[model samples]
Target: MSLQAPPRLLQLAGQSLLRDEAVAIPAVKELPRELFPQLFMEAFTKRQRKVLTAMVQAWPFICLPLGSLMLTPELETLRAVLDGLDVLLAQKVRPSGWKLQVLDLREVDENFWSVWSGAPVSSSLAMSQRQTGEDCPCTGRQGCLKVVVDFCFGFPDIVLQEFLMHVCEWAQQRKELVHLCCKQLVLSVRYVNEVRKFLEMMDLNCIQDIEVHTYREMDSLEQFLPYLIQMKNVRKIMFRHFPGCIYCSPRIGAEIMWELISTFRKLDKLQKLHLDMVNFFKNHLQQLVRFLKNPLVSFTITGCWISESQMDRLFLSPSIHQLKELDLTGTILSDFNPEPFQILLEEVAATLEVLILEDCWITDSQLNVILPALSRCHQIISFNFCGNQISKSVLENLLRHTVRLERLNSVIFPVPLECYGDNFDHIYWERFVQLRAWLMEILRETQALRKPEVILLCTLPCLTCGSRASYDLEPSPCSCGKLGREP
Candidate 1:
């Protein structure tokens, strides 16, 4: 059979029969290793206690996703899953380069953590290597295999505890290599104490990347700052604030924002930093400016409230001049002065290759003030300024300024206000047609230098779906001639 066809096909065929429990129970051993992952999923969903236990013992590789089992209120299925996993850990013979790796502990909540952390391990759980060197299964050198665990909070207490203890036991066996190999840790801020406990249990110094997502309002970040600061070698950091149950409540204070930035300053090897839905105060802008002094390759700040005065210092900073990709989408600056933004554009004209400022409320006056500097952004390859109040003539002039930008390749503009809003019976079709002509003209003019990807979306939000949807306007006689919002 191996000679005639590939093992993957045979594996898929055998697992197809496993859907019928009676047939699978009899032919389980005949299933190939390639079908192991699929069988685990089926057993988990079907609650086939025996099959789940059997597959765990037969699993070829070491990485196990304990969380995928979806710990139910009943512990019977959970016990079967864990017991089968123990057998693999205690196996007498193993593959040459094999060692336990990558245990996923996601959706772990407070209740789950409480039960497992202090639970006693069975003496029978000890593996052959710990008992004697006679039938030692692991031949891989110490520190050869790295273990990465994906942890997310909000699991019930008992389940989370069991998951943590499992990780702790595994780490104990490979004490020397475990920390060196562990790479990334992600935390969601629903329960701060739970996050702290998990961090305390793990070796933070060895981790390379940390991502923290916030859903609730945290009054102070004192508990997380210290452990994060200790991870000096961490290279990438991401902080995103998600709207919580209080839909209208603010996310964080200015002081907290500065403190977060200050925490980032402690890491010398930081390369990429992403902050979303964060508010910035004028006083806190200095901390952000200082953090940018490092030669960062990518900087993204979205849904932030930055005044025109603050934008002035941020854009002219020496750090902005070195960035390769700069994204400032959803940062409201149109309500303030435009001179500062124009100056900042001039400073980054030579270095920035990608610029995104969607939904920033940029108007004709603002575009006019920056047209001279915008033309100098010759290196920009991708540009997006959609969801702003730009008129047809102003946009045409804007294109004329950027026509000579040989490197420019992608552009997405907002529909001019003249053609936006609710207009039935193709009232603005002529204006829309004129806009399309201008776009085609630009393409024809720049055909030799750069063929840019240009997209212009309808300015009005869809009355039905609440999303922007462009209309297919025909030349008055076609079916699309009647294109308009449905009543």
Candidate 2:
């Protein structure tokens, strides 16, 4: 009997022959492609450096898995992977003109990698020390191509050191090209020192947007203060972290909050500021208004607690008087004070085009306070008041005020509850129908005047044992036993 070739060897020979061919592009989108990352991990776990390197070379795109590459059993494999990435990046032609898009180093964590691989930290670092490589192929090529680097929090010191060293190597090889294309940088507050060292290597002037995020409470981020103040061209700055209780840890949160606020002073071109899971107090409120480059165009604060006094100061601040968009979603307006918000609305009526107050616990009295000023906000186009405690009357009045505003287009309102003594009777379906009809009538009249369609979204009521319920769009059963329609 003739001996047949082994099935595994045949597969290997097929892959090898494809690699040797000048145009051996694998199926980039087939179901089998999804197995590549798993195969890479398995190869790393088994200490198969040659197989890993071969896989890296066979990778159709330039998704250089730096973390997995660093885990290779042989230094030659690491070097080979880097060299392969450089070669692929340098090439300009492909069947489809797709290029490398994301360089994800977020997995470069020393402790986690060490624990998962059961390897000593020192040995891993020593083996992974990189040498200066040749320039990137895409370098010096004229194109609008760019890449986004994931440098968020929780990465270990050693990984950051190696990553920054590689970055320095890339910059040294192709300074002008990297400078022209590397306009976006992502940093983390968790690893501040690594962040500082990485920033030291970058040309901060070339950076247009810096996205900084944190996973836990950090005592200080003062290390980034020096570099941030110098990024004059950065038009957008975003600071986001894990959400914390809006009312807890007032003192500790305020200090770090102050440090973050102080950094915004000299950024003259900073037009947009987005803060998430950040705590704010009355004192730190002005730092936002003080951003006087071109009048703070947009400001967003979510999952934060702002005292009534602070809200007062924020709305009345002349710095943001010409602000175009303001969002205070997920903020506790517990005091029910509407003067500051009302004044803020009145001040920016001409320029304030979007206002969002979702989940603010805004009562009918509070809504009533702002109704006059809100109605006068002729430029206000998008308004979201979902997740509040307003009644149907307040909503009707709100629609009446906004109807005359020519720029009004989108409105999101909470579903008014028809409850009696802690039990939800119905969803006030008739009131909602009447409100929608009124809005439609307004739209029809405006259509005669050549206006756009007004989009409205109403929060849904609870059909299951209706107490104060969650958000949906379905109408609930009413005790009145009448269909929600015009008679």
On lDDT, the candidate that comes out on top is: 1
**lDDT of each residue in 1-487, candidate 1, tens digit only:** 3566444554456458666877776565566655555566656667888777766555554555454345533456656755665665565565453434434333332222222222344442322122111111232544333344455444356865565556656556655544423346666655667656566666665566677666655653545777778877677777676445444225467666777778778788777666676552334554564674376656777877766666777766665566667787777767767777677678778787988877788889888998898888889888887767788888878767776787877777666777654552233656777777877787688677655655444443444444554532322122332333332
Give the winner by TM-score: 1
- For candidate 2, what is the lDDT? 0.57
Candidate 2: list runs displaced more than 4 Å: 1-20, 23-168, 180-182, 214-217, 243-262, 280-282, 291-294, 334-336, 419-454, 460-487
Backbone collisions counted per model: 17, 2
Q: Which ten residues in a row have the lowest lDDT in candidate 2?
A: 126-135
lDDT of each: 0.60, 0.57
| TM values, all candidates | 0.68, 0.60
Off by over 4 Å in 1: 1-9, 16-85, 88-145, 154-190, 206-217, 245-261, 280-282, 335-353, 372-381, 400-409, 421-427, 460-466, 471-487
Model 1 whole-model lDDT (C-alpha atoms): 0.60
TM accuracy, model 1? 0.68
Name the Cα RMSD for model 2.
12.1
